[model samples]
Target: MAVVVGVLAVAGALVAVTGPAVLRWWRPRPASADLIHGPGMWAALRPVLGVAETERRRTWLHLPVTVGEAGARIVLRLPAGWASGEAGTRAVDAIVTGRLPGEWAAHWCRTVAAPYVEWVRNAAPDRPRELPKSVEWMQTGDPLKIHFGETPEGPAFVHTGTATPHIGVSGETGSGKSSILYIPLVAARLAGWLVTVIDPKQNSLTEADEKSGIRIHSETYECVMAIAEFFVSMMAAEKYNGRKYRGHSGPDSPVGRLLVIDELPSFREYVAAWWKYIIRERGFPPVLVWFQLILMQGRSSNHRVLVGTHQFSLDVFGSTMARDQVGTKMVVGEVSIPSWTVAYGAGAPMVDYDETIPGRGVISLKGRRRKKTLADGRIERAEEIQYAYITPQVSDLLDACPPAPAWWDAGAMAPWITPRDLARADSAAAVKDFLPGGRFAGGREDLTPDTDTDVQLTQGSMPRSEAMSDVSGPGAVSGVGEGLAVADLVEKVGAEGIEEQRYTIAQACAVGIIRKKPGAARQYKSAWIKEGKPFPEGEMIRGNASYTREELESVFGTPEEDADSI
Candidate 1:
């Protein structure tokens, strides 16, 4: 027992000490001593210049750059044939300049000093430029491409088109999936190809611009019928009066048509029905498919689908349809996913199921040709996938699209009101005139004069004689800040009884209209009362919590626009 305990104690001690040491060693390192190239410059060339030990062209390095008073610098223990000749000089210049493209040019400059200099600028075949607006197509790397196992491992990874791209996107709810999806839509639309999108969550598809030639609909029977109609349209465009597929002419040419549906499982029972409708009734060939989960259960052998999910099902590869049809499978988050390649006969590597990797993913790539003389003169096995950052680009075009029309404003809830409604509707004072005393019996009625109105108010603008309820107990406003407490704000707006007020505030915060200060409570202060005496526009009154004017402006914008923006 003592010997066993000693062994156990040794094991625990090893885990406590060595485990952290190993982790610390593997952790992403900060830029230390200078590299011949800066990080941005290194990133640009990573795809071209394959790493030394790895058989593939994707170069994985742990060089984190910190921008400081002295500018940005990256430290790396460069390999042989690196840091030689004019390219080396250019790399130094690029680091000093702190510009990417300039660094890229310098890193790839002609170098007679190194025989392998030509290999440093190796360009991967360019993939189709048509990708979503939100997804910026940064340079490709073997680690990124082979990370999926769709493509073979090699120095040739960049410019490989989205013909087969494995994307990994991570964001919380309400963090803008619509914005992310828009990029591929733009790409497909520009390429004169059709994009079929399935958004089961339903939030992202609403309010997308119609002019962009996308067909957005809910996951309903009617929506399925519309999808059938779209299939028919594609069939007609391709068939050419029963000639052949992929052959089209006239105004009905299959140029650009994307069918987007949100909330897929809502119509899960209708999937087989829609398939029959498309194949038997409509007869459409698939161009591109975006499945944000839901319809991923079933697959078709002909079309390509981009399956996005927080958790990927291993069952995906079990189907021949998924293996044969789905070219690119993109797992979005660092969540646990079932191995798809094992079922599909593809040797895709299992991703490290580390839930704490932030926004990393492992994709199983297939179909690319492998090389013979790479890893120790042995051919690297297939199922190689690469890691690439799916960084979102903030575009004003997304904001231009109108917010989805709410259910509250629907026909059943209320009659549609345009700007003309405000001009034509009778004032609240008009309605109050007919009421006896303009006050309820048990309620407090202060007969304050209408003369104490702000410039915007008038005698006739008193919405009604105050319908004030009785003041009960010590009702005090909670917390402190430049804006009213959520409850108090609702009460001040006379929406105390309305359930939608809280939701309204939440939505406003979601879309960057109002700033929701977390950790500390805040309060409301009116600029009207203070008359500009070091006025803190919107003060977050939590003790020891303060922000500079520059920070506030950057986050919530000028205080005047906050309410309206929300």
Candidate 2:
């Protein structure tokens, strides 16, 4: 009887130790959480297991390391060698994540030589983050620092000054993506900041009341034109000053200027839909090129961009080397695996990201000081937050913030007005100095986009450097120049003409059209010259070679031949 009693005692101890894990394995929460401690991760790291942590060894690069088991984490100073690039990073993630208990994961701080991957076993508290309670304590000491949300730790804020200037917000529809912008925009407006809005949806925040020092652009085509004009205006102002442009302070402060672009993807769709017609056919508008420039150099001038969208990726901002330039990026509402990847970018480990709570999600900011990882289950890259809910009453408070007495208007001039906003002698004289006959709104809200008019390359005079000047010749402006022998030579040959837009570049390339950006159209001239063929339609605009699609089709085969080859 004594021996049997002892055996039962041992059996009871074993059941007590393993029962919860066994039960958790048998019936995981919501079915998806079953693989929380992914055993496959261990198997996935098998190839790299030779040098990484193994059954008996913790040495990496043959160096000694430490191991400690805390409440829920196996704190291991293991091989960071497996964390080299993206593939190696994933392998290390498998190792770190294998240690967590609940549906939680782990991440190493952003350093290669850093010796440890942080882990904690606690199931992160699943309560929704509430913003209304924290509103009274919201200390926005810096006007440039705009408060948008709240984390369990404190109020969430982003600086839009010289240091960290732009903010990017992305989430799915009804995911509070647009809701996140209300506080910042309203706060900035209340602070008497000059606000420019591009509202593609034309519903919310589309109307700009001058009483509040706000201006808005609504149509798709108008937005492009406005962006281009703003870019040129900045350049012109910088040139006029004979100094590097600065917007926030000094005598010529553009500090009052702030641009908010909602639905950034809308502009990108416009480009994708009309690329062939816009570029080779009708002198490309340079939308993404100039827009990115604004994001990059606009900081020095206090020109800020607060942009929001449904999806966040490189293509969304037209290939943002300026992505880092944006400074603060947040994926709000119930964050998804895909959004967490694109929003925070690669190598950011996401644990406990199943945030379905409204106005709450994850955010990553540039230039933040390194903080010690807490046992509370938040990593540096994947910091969770609850955005300030812009309740109607709170909006009433924001709406009450008065506008600045001084105001600046982008549409103070007319479309037909001369480049300098002064009287011009005549159209012919204007032609000599200015590249006229293109759409120029100057931020006029009344103006609609004119597809018939080409985009005006610049607002004011672009000084003709010998580099900026093109002469009429095979090497220069081929078949394009007033009073040139090339015109008569073209007449004698009775040149074959075909309409531009004969084939999209893909179709053209099917029959072999070699053209890339900046010169996607110009390459045709070079190709013709290479074959010792005459391209009688190559023209030079502002020193860049411009080609009409009609001319390209005439030289290359027609659309029928191009399509047939495809």
Candidate 2 C-alpha lDDT tens digits along 285-392: 456776777788777545678888876677777654676677778787666677666666555677464456666677764445564342432233557677776645
**Clash pairs, model 2 backbone:** 247-301, 499-550, 500-549, 500-550, 509-512, 509-513
RMSD of 2: 20.5
Whole-model Cα lDDT per candidate? 0.32, 0.51
Over 4 Å off in model 2, which ranges? 1-141, 162-164, 206-211, 236-252, 271-283, 351-354, 367-380, 391-410, 413-566
Q: Estimate each model's TM-score.
A: 0.32, 0.49
TM-score (C-alpha, index-matched) for candidate 1: 0.32
| Candidate 1 per-residue C-alpha lDDT over 360-432 given as tens digits, one digit per residue, 9 for 90 to 100 | 3333333345532332232222232233323242133333333322221111111122223322321311212
Listed per model in order, the count of residue pairs whose N, CA or C atoms clash below 3 Å is: 40, 6
Q: Which residue window of length 10 is worst by lDDT in model 2?
A: 474-483
lDDT score of residue 351 within candidate 1: 42
Best by lDDT: 2
